[model samples]
Target: MNNNVKASINAVIVSAVFGAVQVANAAFIEDSKLTLGMRNFYYDNDNREGGADQREWAQSFKLDYSSGFTEGFIGFGVDMQSLVGIHLDGGKGYHPDSNTFTPSDSDGSATQEWSSFGATAKARISQTEFRVGNTLTPSLPILIATDSRLQPQTFGGAMFTSKEIDNLMITGGQLERAKGRASTNSTGLSVPGGTEESNHFRFAGADWKVTKDLMLQFYYANLEDFYTQHFFGLIHIQPLGERQSFKTDLRYFKSSSDGKNGEPGYRFNNNGGYAKNPGEVDNTTAIAMFTYTFQSHSLMVGHQRVSDDGSLVWLSQANVVNGSGRNEGEGGISFYSFTDAMIGNFARAGENTTFGQYTYDFADAGISGLKASISYLRGEDIKAVSGSGPDLHEVETDLRIDYVVPEGPLKGFGTTLRHGVYRGGGTSIDDQDQTRLIFNYTYSFF
Candidate 1:
């Protein structure tokens, strides 16, 4: 079918799914078994040099309902979500600023507002459960569902999770589409900014508890053409006597071309965009991070290195199907912000990085629900010419204090602040500084 025809069909499908959700709520969801939640965010992003700045306010509403059980060991339930966004400080020039939202007009800018919502049907039998529709599935290499906004991103597909085996939990899923935080239009997931041709995606994984404080995970995902990745993770916690614990997290990723750009994709070729890039390659990466916690304080450190290739290919942004998409997110494997997320930002070609971080929990200090953290990521010997570049150096610092009102109508409101700077590379315009301030409040009703 033609591009326009396909787009029209996709839109129709979306409407039908949405309509089905509403019908289910009215006909099947029991009022007495209903639960509701809402989250509101006030966000601001400022850029000093360019005329580009962002200000936005958003609210997300979630509804959950289930009928106790169908008079047997088998039970059924449904999950629903409704999201909305309001334009606070963004305009036309900030077209890309709309990210997950709608694109700009002919003048090249962002739209004022947008929103999307979805629902799912689920069944449970013992320790195994299955669900279909909008849900968060962080199944390692396959899908890293992000939650960096007022509402978390979700995948439109079906998933099965079970813990029937002793000390072992198994998961697998087939996701056909995904919904970003800013937009309600679900799109077929591509690599970075890839095509939406292929609608079939699969993943399977297992997590096992080796001991009281030790766990291991294995996952594999085939993202058709863009790349196929395998992930291995180990987490261990060692108590340093009473009131102290040392945490260790280790991860390994191996990825290569799949499908078209992959050995399977019909479009696979050596003359493609990925083939010409210097550092693009089928390679692996390993990371080891450790944390020490003591009396409301913690310190963390880690090291990461790219394998033989000049540039990291599989990790670059691209269309999962077209293999020539965009990296809308931060790009690269960033180590700056939180030690947990390695999202946004990209490492220069042939680069190796070292990072460290520290966090303080102020609850014991009588500041309940308040905490602060900071981290640094440094990468040197980046590619410049033919696997050579002007090396990369970046630093990011963030401070946030949240106070959930102990007694008030807005008892769960809080605030946050973030700042960061990056330098080096030849992908886009040189280096830049970024900052964000957010005030948020969330509540739930059952």
Candidate 2:
């Protein structure tokens, strides 16, 4: 880690210890909770074409500590998170020298191990809470942290949330930097093809429950010199019978160019797809999803359409290099859309995607703690990068199974297996098949 990060962590530790001792209250000590989480992951990818395959296995440990608020009208507390990852196996030629899964050594090989540490200080008053920290993980409609890898990505920022009104929640925040999942350092925010970094990311949103089964959402976000985005969402559920229900979800996004966007070094790649105005952000996306549940089965279907002007935009630091002129493995992002699939994101320009999923809960069949799901997505009418050619196409299918040990010595232990197959034509993405197996367990201490 760098000197700045080390100093921040040390200061947090000192403050946490001193504050707890000074308070000397039951709420601060007796209600504190700590948990240790472990995950073992194995990943494999096979390229159908003559490309390099990626296979890696690793184990990660996370220590999370949360302290209860002190006794006061304005309660105060602290939270800390520590993570460590160890590479178990990734033979030569199998582990690519990319920050996608693991940090790379100077020799272009996987690093043996990596670790990170962060802390947050928070205060609560009435129905509102304010927090400032380097471990913020926001799940707003405009920006969502990525946690698909061994470590969850984190942001350094300050935020506030208010729930003073019944059935209403308001949230806003400003994030300055982000820590990549596979690296120990933090970097500024940018987009997929942006080389220059921007430290300002501001967002505000509200969720209002209009009725017992209907909710509405609206949010706005801006990334300095990158893009400004607005989001709207609606969700409704209708009960059909004792064991059956239907859900409807709708989402829409509008994005446009921000300050200095389309300039050299701050260009948007349009997700490597077509762009009406090269390097400029101008797009709108609409999505609708419906789900029906009956007994032990659930089915979901969705459709998404991207504007013909540009691809969708989101906050990313993938292309930003650290001071050492090397990537810090900060390359994964999650958008609040169903098109953000396991193997591919179907958010290219002028693209139309149709997708569906089927899931089963084995508990209804006397097999508790077991579940399975399969999904498929096809994207067509994708404009080529040149903006004047035959439309491109891509498809992906994913299968997943999950199980947890229940009512046994290994209770709470969980296992997951996932496989995805992707095929594409006339796009930069290649055909590939990927699989992942993961084991997770956590123990708590109070």
Candidate 3:
């Protein structure tokens, strides 16, 4: 973290402590909650075509504390989190540059250990709350924090959420920096092919529940010097029978170039595609999904479409956006989309993806703590808008199973297994397979 950022966070912490003490209310301490979580993760990836396999094993500790508000017209609270990762395995050549489970060293190797600390100071008035500092996961469709790795991603920013009106939520935020999932340092924001770092990311959105079964959403986000994006969404659920239901989800995003997009250090290649308006952002992406559920079984089908003019845009600090080669750890990012799957995002220019999944709960068969799911995504008819070479295609399959202890001393313990297979040509690697095993346990102290 930078010195100025550190100082600002410390100042906020001190102010929050002082405010709590001055309020003379025990609610801040009486309603506080603390949790100690442990995660053991093992990741293995194999290139079916060639190259060495990538494998890494690590143990992570997460300490989280959340305090209730102090008494008053405006209540004050604080939230703190500390994450530590200790490497258990991953010998020489096991840690690939793209692997984000462990921190990368100066020599492109995995470090033995890494850690980070963050805190959020918050105030609440009525149904609205304002917060500043590190928020682990943001509930925004334009940006998402990846938690698939050992340590989840976090952003340093100030955000406000208002739920004063019934069935309506208003959210807006300004984000300046982000700490990657594996890195201890924070960096500015940019897209995949953007070389310039834009510290300012602004977004505002609202969600309105029109009825008990339908909701509408509209959001706008701008990444300075990168792109401006707008999102529109609709979700509806219908009950068919006593044990049957159906759901519909529709999402759309339109993005255009912002300031300095075509200038030096701000140029984008559209993720190596032929951008119709070179260095300028212009794209539209849409996805629709329908699901049917009956008792213990659920099935879904979805399709995603990307405009030919340019690729989709989201904020990511990866690829050394500022043209600095010193920070390689900030290479992992996640976007808010259904296609952000286990193996691939399937979000290239001109790509049309069709996918499906089937999930089942083993409780129907007397196994109360087990669930399994499998999904497949196929993308085709992809071509550059500038009339580049041949059209591209890709395919991915994923399988996942989770188990949680039902009771006894290990009630909060859980185990998850995931496997994925990816195959493609342009913009994607050759044939590849990946597997992950995770064990997690959390204990809470009030």
Candidate 4:
């Protein structure tokens, strides 16, 4: 975290601690909530090629507490989160040197366990709220926190949201550091293949609900010394019948190099694809998706296109080393793209991808809490590293099923099964089949 943010957080904490004792009231104590969430995750990967496979099983627990605002014109509250991960199984050979699944020990084996704690201080006035902490998980167009593993990624920073204007919502923030899903340490932010860290990330965005069925969004983000990005999006829904609807979603992004982008310690890998200026950031991407739903069945189809200049860019710290000169176990990230698949993200330069998904809900068929989905994506014309020769191609197929107990003793218990197959030619990625089984439950204390 940055010095300014640390100072602000410390002041907020001191104020909140002393003020609560003096003005503890009904709204603050009565409306508080607490919950404990448990997850058991099993991951298995079968490398079709002659590569090492990864298999691991782990258990995670998360405790969350949120207190309501104190009764007044200017209200104050706080939120706390604690996460613990236990490495149930993952032997020496199965645990890779990378920190994609579990933290590694000094001997390159899985660590026994890891844990972290964070707190957020918040204040509200009218329809605007401000927050600062290390536990912010933002899911916006420019940034998305990764939560596909044992724990969710978090950022250390400050943010604000305002709904003061009718039909409009505004959000903005600045982040300085991030805590990876598998590691207990926080590190400076950077892109893939960037060894030097950039401590400043700033963004602002707004969403406008123009009508009951239409919405528009715009956002701008910049990672200091890395890249700057702008996003535009549109979403619309048309009701065809009482039980039928059609949805349209469109998105576009334009990114370019920022200060010191192509320098030695700040080079971008372009997602391991060809870049026009080698380590520079330059890219434009567009996507359009349509979904039609009828009763319990829904189908979605989308197409995405990437410019020939470079691959898409987003915030990442996977390649940044820690003080001990070892990998920081921060190898995963989530982006705001439909091509972010189970095993591969088809955002290579000059790549054109088409994808489709089919989903079914069993509620109408007497199984109230069952849902299944299958999706397929194929990308062609991927630029080779040499920027010459034959183009590369890749494909991925994923299948997922989820079920929850509806009315039994384990009413809130849920299970999910997911499988993915990925195949590629002329790329660094290996052909593999991956499967994941997850069990989840949450208990609330009101």
Candidate 5:
């Protein structure tokens, strides 16, 4: 049988097996949770600097099932997710050039429908848990999964998390491959400008709560043949008054080239910015932020700086498929940084970004489930790889509003609207405007 046919049969078998096991084991049935989710997504991006516009609309569904561990010193359980996406709008003129929303067909057209299924088997013992299979492993400072499109990305991997030590949490994992949000195919890992593929991504991290209001974290990651990275973070919160508080956050990352990074298949693109040593990775980045929260209002300000050697390090596969050009399908990425904005990420060699945000929650005004926020970011002093040029600069502004139905039949329904404007100077940077409208609802069947 074909792979798709086999996958379908396996899904059916898994559903039946889980259903039977639930009925056989009272713990499994009693603790299991099943949820069905629906999402209506509309996206539009206008490149003011001259490029084809990207626009698309789609409807998606997700079926998630998670069972509790059975009784024993080493209990076992299972988790499954089935995802489906259907094209709702966007014809030839509005098809995506970045392939950010929909997968491309053999004729370079959007597919009518796509689906994916994944399952993870887990075991728990003495406050630690082990999970294996297709998993959405928790997001880490080193590898943040992309979930901006119709279906969240999933990776084929195994991970272990432990909270056995008081006031501390530890995590470690090995991931082999990833399925993008828009495509049903799973692909090996690689960075931008890379032609070779790597199936191994290893990482370990720990978070220690030093005090009631202070926490410290350290993490290390190695992407085979790409690079190795170390991250450090600190967060502290202090009570100012009955309804006021102060918060501080600091983050740092140090990265260096790994085996084969400068080889033919593992080269770095330098991403328009200058790399002190082309094709090799070497960079340091730091960010600090302070926030004040009073009642329903919050104000935050932060600054980030990247070392002069290379662009900040993160997993990006923008050029891995279809030979490092535009119109390739299934490209999206995410990172754990304050400068990771909706329209752009202000991370480049010698770049400095200053940003701030203001937010208000309507709960204090008797409007529960309603909130709004606005943010602005300015980046400058970006170094060019050519070693001779004026410094580049950019600015981005974003506005967001979120609302969830508080009661009635649509009590659980939610709506989110976001708009972003970006203007910059550089070969890689572009002036653009983007908007997203999303409606989502989740129903439980348990």
Candidate 6:
């Protein structure tokens, strides 16, 4: 075993022993979970220019224990998580240039696999809780948790959540570093490379419910020297019929250079627009998506517009939009970077895309855990749009299948297959048929 492996095991053992002691001393063990899974991908990058097929395996474990108030006004608790990954296939040639999903070996070849385990101390009062250590933070308009791979991305930070007010939720946090999806190594926030400092990412947000079917959200984040983002969102769910519902998601984001807008202590729109100041880019984006569901069939369509001089803040929890996840080409059409990034950065100045998708659940047909969907998006005036110039159009489609064991030790076992096709203008060095095959049997031990 290497030093990294040794350290991971040691950490898990230490947390286990510590939890055991707490249990022996009468602490309540509230929750515990374990999941082992694998994801295999038959990927083609740069439109068949490069292809790598491999099966990646990951194992995850989590345990939580909360104590009753000791001083009546104060409460305490502990949370622990252990994550490990193993390389089933794909060598260095298969790995991407960025270090978001997996790690690189010292020999330049693919390392067998890596693991990371972490624990956090918790404190609570009335309806507010504070936690310190490493965990999963899926902040929209900024950092998002990616679970399309065998493992999920994690973060090391201190977070505070409060529910003192009625019908409103407030969240705030300060993150120091981010742990990649497949490796134990943690990194500071950056656009893609390790060229920036670690203490650059910070965020805060609030969500309020206006009515039973209406909700609103606001968020702010700073990526240090890179950029700062502000987001606003609205969601409404309405029942159309006995078994039909319509959901509307409207989101807007304004982004600009922060701390260093080409100068220290100066942050604004200095890039002037996309590709103009390729050295430093910024912009604002808005999206309004509407989905209607009836029985097991659903249809969704939306229009997204990226204004000049601001960057689109992709998110997960609430702000960032979905549907763009199953693009086929590495850059041509789709944008599914959350789980497995095929479109690393899908942004261009003054770009606008009209998107539509259709989905069906096989459960209505008496099949469970089986779903299928197809989507298409056409973008215009991307990268360089001069009032009425050339337009870029992209089309993408996907087919997926999922199956899980219903009972026994393999109860949580399941698999997923995703295939896509992307095409359009200014593909940015990416085009071709791409397929990712992920099959994993999850085992839950509580």
lDDT accuracy of residue 309 in candidate 5: 91
lDDT of 5 by residue, 425-446 (tens): 8748679999999999999999
lDDT of 2: 0.92
Worst 10 residues of 1 by lDDT: 329-338
So what's the TM-score on candidate 3?
Answer: 0.92
Clashes of each: 31, 0, 1, 0, 1, 10
Candidate 1 segments exceeding 4 Å error: 1-71, 91-109, 136-142, 262-281, 310-344, 406-409, 425-430
Off by over 4 Å in 6: 1-27, 30-46, 49-72, 91-101, 139-141, 263-273, 313-345, 385-391, 406-409
- Give the range where candidate 2 is weakest over 10 consecutive residues by summed lDDT: 317-326
- lDDT digits (tens) for residues 25-56 of candidate 6: 45334333344444443343345444443333
Instruction: For residue 157, give model 3's deviation from the true position in Å.
Output: 1.0
Q: Could you tell me which 10 consecutive residues in candidate 6 have the lowest summed lDDT?
A: 326-335
Q: Local distance difference test, per candidate?
A: 0.58, 0.92, 0.86, 0.92, 0.86, 0.58
Compared to the true structure, candidate 5 yields what TM-score? 0.92
lDDT of 1 by residue, 136-209 (tens): 54535435666666556677788899999989999998877766554455566555334334566778899899
The 10-residue segment of model 3 with minimum total lDDT is 318-327
TM-scores for every candidate against the unseen true structure = 0.77, 0.94, 0.92, 0.94, 0.92, 0.77
Better of 2 and 6 by TM-score: 2
Selected candidate, larger TM-score, 3 vs 4: 4
